[model samples]
Target: MNVFGMGLPEMALIMVIALLVFGPKKLPEIGRSLGKAIRGFQDASKEFENQFKLEAQQIEQGLNTPTPSESEKIAPKEVATAEVATAESNNHATTSSQQS
Candidate 1:
């Protein structure tokens, strides 16, 4: 609804006031400090996000794994073999019944 969320006249007035209050000598210093603070905040936030992601990944892997201190793992191949053995026994029983 307004330029820069403020009236153009209001922005000009604020600029004039800031120029008078801080003067040319201090505005550059203020800008520099503000830039540094923004950069530091960005760096810190990125580091926090990276750490959180790493912790989440570690938790996921932990949930998917069986360690030496935990229960033994069941491999897919072993499961498949067990299933095949059960099916073979069932077939043999049916074949023997048919023969008899």
Candidate 2:
């Protein structure tokens, strides 16, 4: 079998070297630690991918959904009309009083 582009022979050689260096007793502990590290890395990578996807989805939804323009965010037309009418009336009242 091939792993990381290394054939069985290459894998066997590395294992032999590691066993000789660490000895049989320490080898299992090292293997367990290596396995645990790999598992933890995989879990962290998956979590990061999931988080990235969730954020991307949120951004996509935000883009798809409509936002209010400047005019839409402002007060409605009816209120604006009423305010203008009141100002005009006040101007008229002022002019009438000035004439009197």
Reference-based TM-score, model 2: 0.73
- Candidate 1 backbone clash number: 0
Candidate 1 lDDT (Cα, 0 to 1): 0.88
What is the Å distance of residue 91 in model 2 from its true position?
16
Among these predictions, the greatest lDDT belongs to 2
lDDT string for model 1 (1-100, tens) is 4876898889889878888999999988987998999999999999999999999999999999966542235566678899999999999999999999
Off by over 4 Å in 1: 1-15, 67-100
Q: Write the per-residue lDDT of candidate 2 for residues 26-77, one digit (tens) a residue.
A: 9999999999999999999999999999999999999999999887867588
C-alpha lDDT of residue 27 in model 1 = 81
Number of the top TM-score candidate = 2
Question: For model 1, what is the error of residue 67's alpha carbon versus the real structure, in angstroms, after optimal superposition?
Answer: 5.8
Clashing pairs in 1: none
Clashing pairs in 2: none
